[model samples]
Target: MSPSLEKILSEIEQLTPEEQLTVMGHLVERVKKHITQVQPKRKWSDLKSMAPYPLLGEDAQEWVSRTRKFADEHREGLQREE
Candidate 1:
């Protein structure tokens, strides 16, 4: 609808299908990179605001370590049931 978008579409129309696909892939990657750069890096503290239940004193590292230990202890017995 916009003049800039119309102009871009007209330019793309002149390209071969392969060329159009290449250009589309490049544009998609550029948009993805831009989005990744714009988003703020999340911190462990940010989880408190987003979580439905309180995290209290337990942080991500502690939870992961405990889970890994439990999984290691149970993995052999759990696999036998499969």
Candidate 2:
């Protein structure tokens, strides 16, 4: 262990059981706060490289048109049912 960590442990050891518990709780809260403040770093290039398939050109346009048509038909069917 690092000297700083060893020193902290020694200081913790010097406390009474109740005081140690309080110190432990405070440390846990501090660690939780620190973890929450940390954010994962990502790049757009990295994300794009990981895509299963590229989205470009005629296929994407056709897909969007087909989806809109399907949604319109489904909504009309639901209205008829009501």
Backbone clash count, each prediction separately: 0, 0
Candidate 1: tens digits of C-alpha lDDT, residues 14-77: 9999999999999999999877766678889877668543366678788999999999879977
- Give the number of the best model, judged by lDDT: 1
Top candidate, metric TM-score: 2
Model 2, runs deviating above 4 Å: 1-17, 26-40, 54-58
What TM-scores do the predictions have? Answer: 0.43, 0.47
lDDT of 2 by residue, 15-72 (tens): 9999999998999999999778867797777776564444553477789899999999
Error of 1 at 17 (Å): 0.5
Clashes by residue pair, model 2: none
